[model samples]
Each structure stands twice: as structure tokens, then as C-alpha cells.
Target: MDLIGAYSDDGAPSPSRSGDGTAALAVVSAAPEVRCGTCHARHFPLSSCISNGIYASSQVDASGYALVESKLVSQEDTKFFQGANTRMIRYNLPADQMHAPVQGPTHPSGRKADGGLSNHRTGHVEDSHLSSYAFDEQYNSFHSDGVAMDPSRPVAISLGPGVGAPPTQPQQKRQRTQQSKVAPAPVDLTQPFTLRTRQPWAEKAAFPEQELTEEHRAYLEKEEKAEKDAGSGKGETSIFHGKALEDYQGRSWLEAPRDLRDDSATSFLPKKHLHTWSGHTKGVNAIRFFPSTGHLLLSAGLDGKVKMWDVHNQRKCLRTYLGHTKGVRDAWFSNDGRKFVTTGYDKVIRLWDSETGAVLGKYGEGKMAYTVRFHPDDDKQNMLMAGMADKKILQMDTDTGDVVQSYDYHLGAVNTVTFIDEGRRFVSTSDDKTIRVWEFGIPVQIKYIADPAMHAISAVSVTPNKKWWCGQSMDNKIVTYSATDRVKPNTKKTFAGHNVAGYACEVSFSPDSRYVTSGDGEGKLFMWDWKTKKIARTIKAHEGVCIGSAWHPLETSRVATCGWDGLIKYWD
Candidate 1:
């Protein structure tokens, strides 16, 4: 019977036989090199001597064959024996010779033993692959010529010519040609040194100093120039430079129509367009009604101008306020209707004299103001709050033109700010997709709401009864939240069906709090039943993005809409 013993250097198990056909057992010994003291050798376990790369051999008795010393081969080299039908014959070496290459024995079938020629791509051991050529010129086959295998080299070997073939001629090393440096041209210290080069089509590539010709200067001097007070005549019909002080002081333009008396009555959705105001040269971004009376209308436009119209009289533009150097983003009137505030992309906020069209105060710190609001209570009218592009809500004293408080916690640009809970607290929304509630004079937030499903709220509107506030979300929906201290999101009352995404379309509530209305990016106006959250009406209001809407305080059926088409339309 054949008895399998242990693995050998060739990665196969060695076997031994006994004379009576009984299984043979292995004999273990320790090398003389491992000594305990003089004239004495320490005995070790079979595994200890093998682990230390030390071996010892003992003479075989008459009943058994001779035993050989063994060495360990890697697991990878052992796979070659399963199909090769090879027998293992172990040989020993000192522990210091482990990294050196050793020649493997040949098989009786005239085939060389596996010398680590592994098909790395397939990871299989090949049999009798005696041809030295491979598809690629590189070979990983290990040979014992006093050279060690380098594991750091790249493995791109394939079956191709010259894989392991010796070169017919020795290759010489290449030599690089040296370049000589030329001395640079000498530069004069008196003249300026310039690297500017001339172009093929021009005389010189550098620009020359500009000077006007004598004839050009003479022509400019002859042009007519207007005097500073040229058009100040009493009857000149100029809105900016003419006399119209008597009409403004009389307060005659502030009278409310008899029809817009009570705001407590139920409101109705506007059915038809009433009047179209087309004076703005660019897109109108915001519209507001004169405080409480709804007798006059105020509009801010991308044309960098604010204009008020006589809503109760001839419906003509009563005055034009021009101070912003860029698009005006938001405008609001003071409680008395005598002063107003305008904030714009120019990073300037100006308090204006509503009647005389004069700038009374300016507030800014070089950051664009996105929206502005006056403290709701009459006692705090001097306080103005503006949402800035730098993620800060700035509160300034309009009377002193000094910034008083700053709220700076939002992670993105602040978009809208609305006073809630009777002007004691305010709610703010930002591009960071968070709704924050803050106390009137506090710089820290009291409530914070952030959800993964929430989009940025571009504008916010409080209901007339002060119970709930709605935000115009960029996800094409208006989301509602309680206006009280809890400030909980009201999922059941969310009003949708209008596309307001990407545009800061303003949302508004009817004066009686019976309906909710908002403009959309498709130039359409939408109204929803406040309780049922159903769309009540959809009107085609403008030719471009309808961005802002306001329901008249007293007239239940009257609503004003402004859009990117640069027109403000009144619907009733």
C-alpha cells in the first residue's frame, strides 16, 4: 500500500512503503546545526525544524526505504501536480537560501518540471509548455541562472516570439546630444525692456496713448448743453423737475373708492383682466397696493425703476421713483403710505418719500438685497428688514439709516422674510431648503425646519387672519405652515397644480383668507380654495413668467399680476 506523507519542494505529497504492505510512517529528527551546548544537539518537533528551514536525515532500517529532507513550496505552485501526474522528491537547503532560485527536476516523460510558468490571465498551470515563445515578448518563467524574480515588474507576458530567447547581438546604450546656450542680446539700461512682438498685419502689437483731434474737440464744444434748471418751469409738465407739490400735499390721490370699503367680506377669484399697465421697459418683478386703502398701486421692474399708478382715478402713472442702478427685487410702503422702501440687485436699499419721489435714506453693505419688509406694527415702522444675498437678514433703522441687527444663520441666500404672530416673530425661507422662525429683535433662530423632500422656498405670504403662512416652493407647489409658535408644516393644505419652479413667484392670500393665489413660470395665475386645497381658477395673465401677484385688500374680486413680459395687469 502507498502512504501519502507530506508536501515536498516540488509541491506534491511524498509517499513511502513498508515491506509487509503496511502503511509507512515518517521519521523525525533535528539538525546538528541546532545545538544546546558543547557536544550536545537540541532535539526539536518535526514541525519546528521544517519551519526553521533546517533538516536532518536518519538511516533507514532493513524494513523501510530511505527518507529525504523536505522544503515548503507556495500554494500556487502546488496546482501544477493535479493534472501533471508527477511524484514529489524533496531536497533541502539552508534557511538563508530561501529567496534564491533553484532548478526544478525533470519528469521521466522528457518534460521539464513547472518553473513558475503560470498563465497569469487564466491563472492555470500549463503542462509541457517547452516552447520559449509567447504572444508577447515578455516572459515570467523563472529559471535558476543566479537571478531572482522581481515581483515589482509589470506582468504583460503573453505567448509570443522572443519571450525567453537569447539576443543574437548585444545592444548598446543610447547617448543624448548636448545643446549649447547662446548669449542673450545686450539691453540698454536707458530704454524700457518689453517683450511685445509685432503681428504680420499690424505695425505694432501694443496699444498707443489716445488723444482727440482738434476738429473732434471743436465739434464737441459746439454741441448744445442744457442748464441745470432748464426744464423747471411751473407748467413744463415734467414729473421729475416740474412743480406738482400742491397736488401731493392735498392727499387727494389717497382717497379710497366707495366700492372698496370693507375687507371682512368674502373674496372671489378674479375672472377677467381689467387694466394693463405697460410703462416698465423690462420685466416687472413685484407689485404692491397702497397700504390699507388699495387706492394706489406700486410696481418694481427689472428696468431699475419703481412707479405708482392711480388705481382709483384715471389709472395713470402718478410718479416714477428712479434710484436703483439694476433690477429692483422688492418694494414696500410704510404704514402711513408717506414713505416706501425699494431693494434691488445693485446692493442698495433706499427709503423713499412716497409723495415727492425723493430718496430719504439708503441702507446696504455691498450685498444684493433679495427682499425687504417694514416692521408690521405702526410703532416699529422705522425698522426695516431686508433679506440679503449673503445669507443674512439685515434690520436697519430707516429713520437713522443705520443697520441695527443682523440674523446670520441661513446656509444659503435668504429669499423671503415675513412677520408672523402679531409682529413678535418672523418666518424666513432660504435657498438652503430650510424654514427658520426668529424673534423680532433676536439674532438667533427659535424654530428650524429642514427636510430632504423640501425644495427652496422663494417667496412667502401670511394669511389675513394670521393663522397660517404659505411658501412658494420651487417644486411647483405652495407649502403651508402654521403661523403660531409651533410652526408645524401643514401637509393637508398644500396647494399645487401650477409650475413655479426656478422663478421666485410670489404667493398671496385673499384679504378675507378664503383663497390662496400665486403666479407661475408659464405666465399663468392660479387661485386655490384655502381649505380644500383645490385649484379654483387658472388665468392666462402674461406673455412670460408671471412672478408676482397681489389681491386688493378691499375689493374681493380685484387682483394685480406682474410678469417677465414687462406688463402689470389688473384682473377683476
Candidate 2:
């Protein structure tokens, strides 16, 4: 008998007990429960089903299929039901009993509908009517053996139509077993092994004799001709015949380019002994070569002495000019090769007649004259520019030693001053971390290279062609700036090698403009290839800080370096 009842988690209003003294499975009457299509089962607790808008069935029909009522099932489940082939169906109850719309069951709307109960008579099941309570029912039939079976279950019958029993599951298949055999140990093919009866290595057949083909005979003839020609000195010239002996003999004396060595291998060999010259009693702060005479060099020392030397002859002190009371910091010769100028800590700039070793004039009254230079081309109206420790650059007339104009923009000490050409346009580097371009004829400042990180530009030198300007910073970095575009100067490269952070006290470009040389705080002199921006060579030029370096004006590969060690080195 079909029984309908409600089940709840609280156990209220339990189902009726059957004759077998067991309660029947609850079928919620107030609200239906939703069933899974594949499992054909519904969730219990009709209160939750009512809240969820689903219902369960009390009895199964002839089709052994049931409906689950709910509008709350997801839209994906709706599509699943529409395309499903399983023996499961969904139903919609009367509108007044449903909380949501009756979207399934496909019943006609209004009075024109002719299926199920009429909506007008029962006041229910109308598409336009809203629902407040609704339910669905699930169905399952019992097999003849009294076990429940799903209508969707597939059955295979063996006998007569409608009367035969269904086939049972087949027995499990058995697994095959493999037999194990003992394998012989591997044979040593390199040695000999007798397999069956006779030893194959002990018996051998004779090789047949064969005649050479025409092609093979021709190859042999060609080889004999080549051998004869080689012996007679007519075959392709031997690569090892003539210069090989000389090349082998010179191998021990030749020096290879550093880059030719493997980067991972040792490329540098330390010198066993160092060569030193100490004619100057005090720190030699500046040194420069005579433009036309490469063998002559000029040096300025802290003793207020400017000495000329024959650098090629064991560094013999040639001439000494003493006038300044303080240390002589810089010295440079004129382009005409007639005179040179020296600036000192006494704040005096002295012009000297080089041939007579005589002092000519003294200019500027400021103390701490750090650097001095003459105009590149003009001899009569020679311009002497000097930077002071008080952050001012004084331009003077070399002929009279009279101050002409002053650049007063640097906030700190002006360390170096350099001219680009003979056009009165020059550049200066200061302790303020700024390099400025100033035109002599104009009153306005032309350009300013301000980089906060580029601190203490101690020395500045411009290439002869004015393509680049290079300088050394107190941060132990060599910086090069492109002068190709004046409006926006760009730093082309930076070279770093010094161990201590301080200015490169002096710097100069080689006469060919192919190399640049600079002296740094650890008494090291460095040569850099201008084009590659790489350090080409380095030497410990002094025992103390090397404060000055200069290239011979006329000798492309010759250079001079001086330092606090009171020593000067001439390199070629």
C-alpha cells in the first residue's frame, strides 16, 4: 500500500509502521524532494525540501520512474533534464503550493489547457499564478526477488518474451602465470669462448687475392707523383718550410695582446723590480713633456721648484726655476715651444722663458691656485686660466699677467680648467660635482653638466678634435662626455680601476688622440684606449699618490707622470 508521510531531523510526525513492524520510508507530502538523475535518490528532511522546493513520491508507477518538483534546481540541471535519456522526470505542483514558477511539465496555460486538473476549478496549476508551496515525487519498482530495482537499469533476458529470467554476472577471469628460467652468464666477446663443439677463433679461411682496378691504379699514380713533386719542391708550398724556423725562434721573445689570452687564464705577469727616480726633494705635483722635444720634461714640486729634465738620460735634472714661496701645483708649455706657465699654492701664476730658464711674469692674487693652462693657438695674447680653492676661475692675459675675466659660478673649489679650442670657449670642473662650459666673450654661462653623483671632478682634458671631454672623479671613476652635441651632453663611458676613492689629479690625451693617460691616488698611472674605453696598461708610477700626468705634445706614444713620491716617470 502506498503511504505518504513527512520526515524531519527533529523526528516530529513520524511515518506509520507496516505489518512487518518497520516504519516505511518517508515520502514528504507538504514539500517534495529533488532526486539525482543518475542515482535515482532524494534527500530527506521534508522541511529542508519545503524550503528548497523539492518533493519525494510515495509509490512508483508502471514506468518505475518518478518526478522531483523544484524550481530551485540550478539552470544547468534544467538543461540536463531536457537532454537526459534516463528514466527520471520532474513535475511542478499547483501554483499556490509552489514558492516559484512552474517551469517544467509543459502544461497548457489558462482555461484552454486540457491536461491534469483544470486550474479554474481547483484554483491551482496556472502558469500566471505564483507559488508558495510545491513538491515532487520519485518512483522505484521491486524485482520479483523482492529487491528494489531502478527502471533505468539495463537487463538482458535469456528465454521467452516477458517470462524469462535475466542473466547473472559472469565469473572472474584468471591471470596467467609466467615460467622462470635460468639464464647463462654473459660471454666475454673480447676473449674467446667455445659455444657448441668447435672454436671459431682457432679455424680461419684464406683471403682471396684481388687485382687493383684502373681507378685504384690511377689514385696510386697520383699519390706517387705528389710525393715526387713534394720532394722536388714543386708541390703546394709547405707552410712550415721558410719562415717557420724564425717564427719558432721568436716565440719566446714575442708578447701577445692581452685580449688574445683566455679570459679564465692568467694574463698578467708582475715585474720583479721597480725603476724609480727621485731627483725632486718634495712632492712633485705636476709634470709635462716639451712639445717639440720629447726627451725634455718639466716638473713642479711642493718645494716651490719647477725643474726641467732630460728624461731619456737617466732622468738628469736639466734646469730649475725657483720663485714661488709655496708648492708649485701645475706646469704646462706654450704651443709655440718658447715658454711655459706654473701655478702654485702661493696663489701666483708664473710665466717662464723655457730656453733661458727665466721667470717672466706672475698673475692673480688669489691663494691656492690649483691649475693653470695657456691658450692652445695664440702666443702673443696668451690666455692663462687658473682655478682657485675658493671656487673661482680667473682668466688672465699671459703677456702682462693681468686678470681679464673671472668665472664665478662654482659653489665649491674649482679644481681644473681646460679649453676646447683657441676660441675663448672653455670648460671647468669643480668640487661641486659640476662641469661648466663658458664663453669668454659672452657674459652668460653657456652649458652646465650637473650630475650629483659625479662628485669632485679633479682633472679635465678635452680631445684635440673636441669630440669628447674626459675627466676623473674623486669617486675613483674615469668619465668621458660626448661633446658632439653641446645642448645635451652624454656620458659615453666610465672606467674604474683605482682602489681608493679620490680624484685623478692629472690627465692628458695622447698626441694622436688614440690614448688617454691619468694618474690616481695610489700612485698608479693608467693608459686607456680612447676608442675602446678600456685600460690598456697600468704601472705603479710612484710610491705615493700620483697627482700629475701629461702626454708629449709631439710624441704620440710618449708620456710623463709625477706624484707625491717626488718622482717622475717618462713612458714611451
Candidate 3:
């Protein structure tokens, strides 16, 4: 079975034997002659010879058939076995010992007759050359990091009189010029790298002056005239569309609870869901309670609308104010609760009469306002400040609608502005990971707080006693800082549990300052004990990131939360 198509010189089927009298296997092919050791046969594909598990050399008869020996003597040849008792021969050949077949009249040395294994195209080879690399006993060198020793350069083995190692060619040295040592100029971080020259988000004319048609120009001019003269109420109106204005006129439906009037009462955690207000067409960004009274709730929405909800009565949106043309980022109520300010991505800060739903004044310097706050002092209610995307704290006079002063120090967009120390000074946070304190009406910064491990503070709230302030850090924690002159962070009071990363969720303090509550990116309301720094409760509050929560200023357990799902919830 080991032989295939073995034939004699007459072309009849017959097996053959080698000179050593061992049985041989033969194969027949029409290819040219091939020789290996003492065996010679016409060449066939190497795959056919090795298919039977034997790579034995073959001897060819005159009729072009190969007789392969059964017992191979060369250890480099392959052998076939049939049973457990059968003998096996194996070859272990190094890669370099293997040679490809030479085509034209190759000799036993595997060299062609004409080229003799030294052809220019095929490369020179000698019979004794089994490997490509040779070893040298006396000369060996290699390159390291520095200069390598050149073997071509001669060296003396012994130093005799007037004789030494040959000198190496001198290497050229690189010449370096000394840098100037003049003192560096001082840098003032209080100023921006360059003055702002243009505002891309600033409001512009409907069309360029040169391109405006007469009708379009006239209509725009008339609208502008009306808006300026207060004829259009600055594009704001009290018309409630389908609802009666009388319901909101005197806020008659709202009745402040008796217990809410006691300012000294301690706060309690809200345990039950009270109500949900679903009016915003997009995500709700921030929410606020009426100052002192907490009778009404205000919310700013990504839909570019501000809504006022009656807290004590209908628990519905009492009035909606439409002013900003883009998403509203923040909203704040004045000390008396009669006025409120709103800032938005439209690059405008708006002041509105809460009762009348009329926009009183609009102010902007072509920079997006991220947050706004009214002066806490009663007499300074007309003055307000805004944190701008341009990295500045802008103090504006609501009555005049003009920016009176700018506190410019932050290297990033300002996110929050809170007045502490009884309205004499204010603290601001920025994306630059800094908290800055400034004296009111002053253009200089009073204190600059920054740290290598600090995160950006998105929102901030001062405790009722004005003793501590907490910031909603983007790191998913509420970090506390002193409200005193030193303005140092209170590291021992970090409240962490819920995730708020990538969101500007606002944190709030309970009315009595015994607890802190914040909304998280997971739409859960998280409250932490002020003294223990442990979570009091976690309530599933919304369907999306709960961006802000507000504890009632007067009530012990009332809380309001708003989220990106476009709904606001009341919990008690």
C-alpha cells in the first residue's frame, strides 16, 4: 500500500529494491529528473511525496519511475509507520540546512552546472556554508548610547616608547548660545488674556442695514420704538391666553400656612411626593422659592420660558413669562418677592415684575449669562449681579438697565454668584475651579481660592445662619466652604452619595440649616444630615437628571425639585 504506480523499465506494474536489498516504494510522474543523495527520479510536486507521511528519497529507473527506500539511512529524512510495533525514523533539520531545488542540471551539491552555486542573480554560496552569519574571535564591537568604537581605526595592543593607540578623528562639538537672563515680566491674573472685541451671541438687527427692504425696516423700527417706549411691555404681556388674569392678580388662591410664618421652626425631611407640575416643553434648569414667604415657586426652563407656580393653593403654574429667545439657565427672586431676574443662553439678563408678568428691563453685553442673583439687602433690591459665560461677574442696576461694574478674574465661565457676609461681599465660582470673593461695587477681588484637587462648583447655597455655604461640585458631591472672611473649604463636611457629574445640579440647605438636599443626575433627590454627612434619604424624583431642588424657606418639610424631563415635583 505504500507504493503508488510503481513500474519496471517495460512499464509493467512491479516493485523494486535498492542495492542494499531493502524494499522500496516508487512513484511515476512526467516531470524532469530530481536527485536527492543516492536517489534520482523525475520531479513531482513535493506535496505528493509527503502525503503518505513519508518524505523518503527515491531512485528512478530508465522509464521515469522513482523507487523510494523503506528504511531510510539519512536521519534528516521522514519515515512512515503502520502499527505500534513498526519502526519509525524522524529527521531534525535546522532551517539553514534546507535548500531549494536548483532548476538547470543540479549536482549533489545542489549547484547548477553553469553557475556552480555562485550566481550573481541567485547569490553566491559554498558547499560548507550552512549559515549566513560568521563569528569572529578577535574583533567584536557594538554601539551603545555614546560613541561607538570604529574597528577600521587601528589600536595598539601594547604601549611602547613613542607608540600608542591610533588617534580617532576629532568629532565636531555643537556650539550653543546662552539664553538671556533678564527678569520675566509680572502677570496680572485679574485681567483676561485680551479684551473682548466682539460678541457672537449678541443680538443683532434682523437684517443688515444695506439689505433691509423699506417695509421690513419700517416694521422693525416700529417694533423697536414700541418696545423702548414700553408700549409692548418689552415683548411681555399679562394675557394668560386661555386663563383668567384675576386668578393671579392678588394671588387670592394662595394662602400661607400658619406654621410657615414661624421662622424659628426646625426643618424636617420630606417623606412623600406631594405634586408634580408638568408645563415646561423642555428640561427644567433651575427652581427658586419666593424669598421669606415660600408661597410661590419659580422655574427656568430650557424651553426659554420662566414659570411661576402657586405653592399654597392650586399647586399649578400661575403665570408663565416669555422673554429669552433661548434656554433660560437660571432665575432668582428679589428680597421682597415682587421682582425676579432671569438669565439665559440668549445672552440676555431680564428683570420682570412678578405680579404683572411684564418684563421691566432687559440687559446684556453680548455674553451668555449662566446664573443671576439679586442683592440680598432690601434697599439694594434694584441692583443685581450675573455670572457670565465670558468669565466675568457683572453687577447691573435694574432701574437703569446698565452694567455698573464688572468683576473679571476667573479664567473660565462663571457659574454661580452668592452674596455672603450680610450683602457686603459676594462669592463666585467658575469653570476655572476657583472660588473668588469680592467686595460689592468694587472691581478688585478680595480673595482667590483655588486648589490642585478642586473641581468646578456649578451652584451654591448659603446656610440660613450665613455661617456655611455649600457648592454643588461637578464631582458628584456637595462641598462646604466657610462664609467668613477666610472663605476656606470645610473638607470634613463633604456630602456624597448621588452622582451629579457633567451636570450643574443645584444644592440647597434646609430652612433651619440642619440638613442639606440636592438633586442628582440620576433624577433622585438626596438629602444629607448637616452634622453627620450621611444621607438622610434618597427619593426617586424624576425621569431624567434632577437639575435643581429648593427647600421651602418658611416650611419645615416642603421641597420642590425640577429635572431634565420637563417636570417639577413637590415633596413633603
Model 1 agreement with the true structure over 26-86: per-residue lDDT tens digits: 3333233243222245543222333334443332234332222353444434432232344
TM-score of each: 0.62, 0.50, 0.59
lDDT of each: 0.73, 0.61, 0.73
Candidate 3 per-residue lDDT, tens place, 87-127, comes to 55243222222343323444666445333334456565433
Q: What residue pairs are clashing in model 3? A: none
Q: Please report, as a residue range, the 10-residue window in candidate 3 with the lowest summed lDDT.
A: 171-180
Judged by TM-score relative to the true structure, which candidate is superior, 1 or 3?
A: 1
At residue 32, candidate 3 shows an lDDT of: 43
Query: What is the alpha-carbon RMSD of candidate 3 to the true structure?
Result: 20.9
Flag regions of model 3 displaced more than 4 Å.
1-235, 241-260
Worst 10 residues of 1 by lDDT: 227-236
lDDT of 2 by residue, 258-298 (tens): 23312221122222222345667899877776665555677
Candidate 1 residue runs with Cα over 4 Å from true position: 1-249, 255-260
**Using lDDT as the measure, what is the rank order of every candidate, best first?**
1, 3, 2
